[model samples]
Target: MSSPEQWTHPEPGEGPAARAAQPSPEQVIAGLRATTEGGAELTQLLTPEGERVASPQFDRYVADIDGEALRGLYRDMVLVRRADREANAMQRQGQLGIWVPLLGQEAAQIGSGRALRKQDMAFPSYREHGVAYARGIDFRELMGIFRCTDHGNWDFKAHGFHPYTIVIGNQVLNATGYAMGQKFEGKVGDEDGEATIVYFGDGATSQGDVHEGFVWSAVYDAPLVFFCQNNQWAISEPTERQSRLPLYQRARGYGFPGIRVDGNDVLACLAVTRWALDECRHGNGPVLIEAFTYRMDAHTTTDDPTRYRLSDELEAWKLKDPIERVRAYLARNGHADQPYFDRIQAEADQFAADLREFTFNMPEPPPERVFANVYAEPSAALDAQREEYLAYLSGFATAGER
Candidate 1:
């Protein structure tokens, strides 16, 4: 098996710009944002300037949700962002080995995650902290994975959110298989039909697993929604480096409907995702939603994005920040006051504080914890290895002292 550093992330076979001979990051993102197809515009509800645009198709999906629900969504986003920031801080403070930051993609996660029904399941990528929060999965559940103290400590089935998949594109297949099972069990074509949603990034679309997942979902007509958080960059590479057309277009080729939404706009994301999920439940499923957003921080704690992207790109995306837009909209329309903002801020602080308290106090898993989940029954080879490991540990009298 290949180590993490040895994994080959081959570029998403060159687009038209590939022949242009090593374009700059700015040039790459510019081309990626262009209309590669029939000038399909991104579906937007809230603009960077805090304007509320009308989307006739998606408006009705959220029309029944009143101002109170909007306030709760905003509050959820604030707390999620605070938790994400704290997770990054934990890494910097040496409490974790690494953390994948989802700084600017808050709306994409919260919007889709909140749209899920109790019966629906979600398969997530590692940076889905916001989605985890929306699904009521506490930050501590993710801490184990980030800290390297445990691969995963949460019960995914219980939470309706699966364990975060570190291997890119793996969750795509997992969700597809789960949805296929739901189909085999006859969960489709009804108002209460169960659906499955899988989350991945623009980068994962280049992977074979994602493509196969799409094919399987389409072939089986599984009640599935493919949520792609196209956060512009897949680590150091931009979306254009992954595909020539916007990611949503790929769904059409697999014989399913696809749509692109402004990932930074919470309302639009919520509406679009709700629409897609409903379509899945009604048996017209296997929908693809390309959330057009940007990753505002390093891919992970160990990466330095400044080495690849320009300062101007970051500045531009900041104006369209998910939380800031909702906050601005609420204030503009008087849905919330300064007191409400202050209360939400306090709640967010408390949430982050609890996260820190729990993660800091969580006991590190024992060395044997690694061997416990390898199999359902005793394995002779693993048992021998475990004995050898214990014997090696006994050789050092000061092993536990550290």
Candidate 2:
């Protein structure tokens, strides 16, 4: 079998051999048809129960990690999945306006998130709840945005996690720009200097900002990693509707290396991301990681998967659930048992209960507080406008309001 090194790059100007060398266009079409027909499954790293599978490129890193670390990685996936489920349920119960469930992509997020060094920073899309969890942000804080409260209440500098960017792919440019700043500050080469990672979805690949992000990162040799979790669907559209070629292949065109990792495998995701970040820290410029996984839930709580997809398709992905696969592997290896499983479940439940209490008790910001920080300094014109607005608001106040 060809090693990951052999599969890492294609001949210049040639497409991915597996994709391009398919016997016929009819075969390609048939393969996609099979996926939709529930005959084919997406790439996966862990089985429904967690077990370690070897991949040539990732073997180097995974070999060095201890069994305890592997168990921790598995635990992170489980906790994140539980949080995703709770958020979805909260949204459905009308407690939140919307929720994006990271149901099947926990490995992609957790693995990559765990790979970050303390100095490294991450820019995330709104669906990056797992990343947020890894960064030590309280999961309930994520509810603030979807709950129609604050934009981002956390400090990015303190946590090394930027506020989740809702505008598709916009954070890519911001991440690149920050990395370029780091390079200017002489922070790209040394082991101690910071690196940046940005996450975006497969659908965002079609946007202009994503392309622009690539251009800037490549041109400046920024210490940035563009992590794309290709979860098969972009809202209601399938990957086929977005591009003809696999998304990873696009990286070579811009003078950077790209790797497609089985995103469903936490170990693989961690290995790949750690390697990519180290490459950047070593002055290798930017790298793109296309994490091949699936979104086993609706695009958001407001979405109806049944309207545009099939139950069998979701079932196929369920077999590759990131958390289950690790658990399976651990059990098989005699590294984990029912007691360990019970403890983890209890921890997850406690987390959910704490989050529920915190979310319900979250204090609302005062209405005038919105205007307090709108400007660095007060201007006469702005002050007059504010006064007029206050007057208009007070017009509706009762006699005791003064």
Candidate 3:
């Protein structure tokens, strides 16, 4: 990470060249305005209006995706979105401690997630519900974490999906280490070689851990793909505040290739990710992909977007709804009819209902359970602390006793 001193700050009115080079605040905001359309640098195979765009270079990656596959992707997004909305409502109803809504970024997650081979592993940030669904993890398994009952108890090795990482950019280091281990074990250099993908947000790029992960992975040539879901906001602060250059462009400095893709376009994300993973499998490791998407909901159930950003910005993004575009594409192509759409919606509703029932009936975990997984080996110190906590908890009398 570069320090303040390392950053080149051109003084005001240095020259016309300097002014043009260093954009003003308004210019930075204006740059984001163009992101909705995804500038020339963004790789997009499907337009937001359901138009299919030609991508000569990457078409082969997704050539196997026919109308049926497209419909499947659409179904995946719908179900994921429904489950997300259900979780949000659960949080509001006091069923969960907090909920991280992955409302508009479904395409970015599902596209990349579906691209992963059974041999490949994924390290996900907290808001990767869509990815979790694509990974074949039971959706019910995820609710326990948000409900504060379990520490993501799902078996990682079986599903090839790591436990949700709550800390920003921390997963990058973990993923890098894992990928380095794979490289050391001679897992690369063939079509069947293993690769790892780590998910992080645009805001996480500021973390020193992420920088360290990048340097280490590059040095080791680890079979890793740095997946950045650049949802345009790091919980309220815009991307401009995080970096002057696009997040993907930052990969060049770390000695790797970086590309931006339309996050709303699932096809583009799938194609780009497949290409990156293929490169890693063949020993050309460490690619950075910035999925230019938007987070349509609050950062979490605890935060309010209205306090910082305008509704108009969100409305503009609504025009590029990830799920809507896919539905449009399926409808216009006659691959799916009104009946299929209705059936999917009904199924999504039923999925949400099942999740709601599970959440409502979730067993309350004992407070001492938090100490269970702190260490693999028994520790006297941990035991003492746990006993002390248990004693403190026991001090409270039940209403019946009172």
Estimated TM-score for each candidate: 0.87, 0.86, 0.89
Scanning candidate 3 in windows of ten residues, the lowest lDDT window is 1-10
Cα lDDT computed for each candidate against the true fold = 0.84, 0.80, 0.89
Model 2: per-residue Cα lDDT over 4-32, one tens digit each: 21222334553444443332444444445
Residue pairs whose backbone atoms clash in candidate 1: none
Q: In model 2, which regions exceed 4 Å deviation? A: 1-25, 28-30, 33-49, 372-402
Q: Tell me the deviation in Å of residue 237 in model 1.
A: 1.4
Per-residue accuracy of model 3 over 1-402 as CA lDDT, tens digit each: 122211223335532211534655545445546556556588999888999999999999999999999999999999999999999999999999999999999999999999999999999999998998999998999998988889787779888999999988999999999999999999999999999999999899999989999999999999999999998889888776677577888999999999999999999999999999999988999999999999999999999999988788899999999999999899999999999999999999999999999899988887888898777799999999999998887777553377
Cα deviation at 269, candidate 2, in Å, is 0.3
Descending-lDDT candidate ranking: 3, 1, 2
Task: For candidate 2, list the clashing residue pairs, or say none.
Answer: 48-324, 48-325, 49-324, 49-325, 49-328, 50-325, 50-326, 50-327, 50-328, 50-329
Clashing residue pairs found in predicted model 3:
none
